[model samples]
Target: MANLIFPSDFEWGAATAAYQIEGAAAEDGKGKSIWDTFTHQKGNILNNDTGDIACDHYHRYQEDIALMKEIGLDTYRFSISWPRVLPAGKGKVNQKGIDFYKRLVNQLLEAGIKPAATLYHWDLPEQLQLKGGWENRDTIYYFQEYAELMYSELGDLVPRWITHNEPFVVSMVGNLFGEHAPGYQDYNKALQVAHNLLVSHGLAVDSFRESGIKGEIGITLNLNHVYAKTDSKEDQQAKDYCDAFNNRWFLDPVFKAKYPTKLLALYQDKFGGFEIETGDMEIISREIDFLGINYYSRAVVEYAEDELLKHKTIKPEQAIYTAMNWEVYPDGLRDLLIRLNKEYTDKEIFITENGAAFADQLAADGQVHDQPRVDYLREHFKAAYQAIEAGVPLAGYYVWSLLDNFEWAFGYSKRFGIIHVDYQNQQQRTLKDSAKMFKQVIADNGLTD
Candidate 1:
């Protein structure tokens, strides 16, 4: 293969969530988040692991920022812990929490790296969860307040802001499937939660505008291309439904300003309707600066009469799989990007989260030789470059993480970072082979095979 070239202005960065990395669960006046409460429940998370001290990023953000600089990152995307900023979820502000983020942003700026801050990454304050969480319409107002506070405090320092990360996962995984924090298994509630999350996104964007902040704001969505298992009509129908549920369910409202009618009809019988309040769609459709896409793999769907969505995912036998059991399909990224550029709004797109989790190990040389990850990233970068050449307005790409932190329900079992973090040995950080390759890619503004 020839060298893969990227735009000179293409942004290179790494991303991490607050709860997944900033493990100061109970320090500096930080209140407990739903994850803190959820992980405390027995048998909730794998290996009974919690993020109490995951990466200790709360105390070592400077060191982490230094590592990011060493990796030649142009930007660093991280989430702000809602509970940390507002201990009770609203009203009084936590000055200590505010100071921490301010310090982190300043350090990144001093290091010549741009800061991209995500307002909410599913770490809703436990108190807010007690008040019905995202399902409760009131949470939207709380989110707006939180967003405004952050913007007022660090809006000038951070150039890029993401309102929410993967609202579909927050709804389906956390609410419907009961796999994440504030777990519940009610379809009706899940639909409501999904709506509320979108509403909060719009509200946050509105707040950003009202603040006169000179920065870009958008929401990050986890999207996948859905493919039919066969040419049969049933399989095609399954693919259509799965695409709507996984991608359009969130995409349409933001870009098209309305929920996909087919999905609405499919769920109407169970819940009567989406219960979309008047003017909710208008708020949800507020124009934004850009769109953040988190692509992983394509979904191969086959018709399944017994499944609620009438779809079943089937992994190809010959395909490579990630530690998360996702197929390693780089073409899916190109397809998804082109589809988004053509079907959705022609807004700027950023690959806010991409990278695979693999079982990485530290060799005797005190280095992590994660070749699989390096290959995964290279293929995906090539895919992204193909999309760019094909006319997608992809502005940047941020790898999934900067360090291997807590992997939510899977705990710390999955490693998705180019840089390895030894959780046992005082959170020792080591740059894996992938990190060195990424540094070269960043420096060259492309991959030189």
Candidate 2:
């Protein structure tokens, strides 16, 4: 292969979520989040493991920041625990909780790293969830208030603010599939949650603009390239419906100010039409400065008469698979990027999250040799470089995580971080070979084979 170079000004960084890392679950007036509540239930998470002490980031943020600085990262993306800030979900602010993030931001700046903050990353305040969660329209206003508070406190310090990370997962996984926190399984409720999430995103963008914050605001969506299993018309139709369900369900409303007509029509009988109130679409369609995309793998769909969406995903037998059982299809990243640029808005796109999970271990040689992860990242970087060359306004890339923290419902079983964390050993961090290679990639502004 050849050298894969990126734009000189392109950003290089890593991302982590709050509930996944910061493990001061009940410290300093920090109220419980939905994850905290869900993980406590029996058989909810893998091995019944909880994030009660995952990575201990709340006490070791400085150590983590130092690692990021050592990795030559230009930016560090992290989320704020909603319950930590507003313990009761509304009313008063938690000074101690605010101070923790303040310290983290200051340390990042002192280390010459730009702080990218995400408002909500599925860690909804338990109090809010009790009042119907994202399915309730009132949750939108609560999110707006939370956004305003965050901007008032940290807006001037952070350069980039993401309203929400992967709202699709929050809606479909958490609400419809009953896989994640605040788990519920209902189709109508899932649609409601999805709509409210977009509303909240728009409200946050509007609040950011109204506050006159100097930073850019956007929302992150987990998107995938959908391919038909065969050239048959039924398979093609299945692929289109799956795309609308997974990708366009979130993308169209934000970029085009409308839902995909095919999906809307298909779900009309089941959902009884969206509970759209006056000015809801207008708020959901509010423009923003950029769009953040989190791409992992692609889906190959075939027609299924009995499936709810009339589509069933078929995994390719010959393809390499990650520990997450996702196919290692790097070209999917390039295809998705180009499609977004051509079919959606031309605004700048930031890869807010991208990484693979592999069963990594610390060898007796006193090092972690994660060659597979390094190869995965290298191929994906090449795909991103191809997207940039093909006229996609690719701006930056943030690896999915900076540390191997909690993996949601999968719990501590999956490892996605380039830096390995010894969970049983006080969360001891070890920089893997992949981290070293990524540092070099950042230094060179590209990939070297």
Candidate 3:
């Protein structure tokens, strides 16, 4: 198993989002986020699961940090709750909400674990959505204000910060495609949200600099190394659509400051443009210090006339699938890293999230045998190392999660954590196999000898 050693300076961390982990949906005067309303709607969430209590990380954060210490994690990347802090999206600051994060960050620092903070993870304040969500331009300004507030408070302690997580899924998939919260089903509207999110990202980035914040700033994107299901002309077009859907939609605007030509054709005639504010790209394209990437699996595209999305989607393939039914294509990891290096060419990269979910069950002895997840981590870690060998500047790898929290629409059912959570008693601990493997890997610093 030990083939390629990780760089001695490589970072080893784990990730978690706000809504997915920090439950207490209505505690301490926290405002409702889009996800709060979405889960309330009939059929919006599986088993009508909501993050009302989640892992209760809000209350059990100390216990969670203890678990991280047990597993020997170096860093813990988590997101801040936007609505929870600014109830109406930007008027009054909730000291209570701010206090929650202060405690979490201090605990991590005390534990000798680096804290990586993501500004937004799609838990937009419902008040903002009511005022038109990402479709409205004002949200960007509001987000800048929120980022400034966060940096003013915690920038001294937390050294790493991420602006937003995967606009492709939240703005396009959630709002545009009507699959997630603040749900709407208009392609043009989705573009508006996507553009606005980037605008907000730039504003936040600038806010970080103007405030003289310390440490690094970046964004987390869910990039899919997509491929055409076949060589036919139609299939190629399908793949092209997939590219627009997955990679180009976010990357083109962020890196090149231009929308993908094909993607523009699909919406420019309908919606004007999102990141059109002057001097915004100067911030968006600013020399960032690092990049965080969340890679789950490969997505194949074949022609499909869907009702909402209306192009193509993942097709049947003979690859192993995750519990979420995503195909496990290790090469896609290496491919994406190479492309990112070629594209950005200016920032360091971190595999912020790379983990698989399977139907895991606690055994009679209270341990879960997760060989699939072990194989996934091993292979992708090597893929990351391959990217490093190819000069990708790949710096670290963080498993998708430290604990299995709420999986949004899928709720608590989908487990992606190295540590399992017993929701009943709010007990948290680590799995035997994955924890053991991770400890040795961290101790060795790399799989290679």
lDDT of 3 at 156: 96
Model 2 collision count: 0
Model 2 worst lDDT window (10 residues): 269-278
Tens-place lDDT digits, model 2, residues 325-411: 999999999999999999997999999999999999999997999999999999899999999999999999999879998999899
Cα RMSD of all models vs. native, in order, equals 0.8, 0.8, 2.2
Write down the worst ten-residue block by lDDT for model 3. 306-315
lDDT of 3 by residue, 195-235 (tens): 78888898888788888877999888888887777798877
TM-score to true structure, per model? 0.99, 0.99, 0.94
In candidate 1, what are the lDDT values of residues 1-449, reduced to their tens digit? 88888888899999999999999899999999999999999899999999999899999999999999999999999999999999999988999999999999999999999999999999999999998998889999999999989999999999999999999999999999999988899899999999999999999998899899898999999999999999999999999999999999999999888998888987997678667888899999999999999999999999999987889999899899999999999999999999999988698999999999999999999999998999999999999999999999999999988999999999999999888999988899999999999999999899886
User: Which ranges of candidate 1 are over 4 A from the true structure?
Assistant: none
> Which sections of candidate 2 miss by over 4 Å?
none
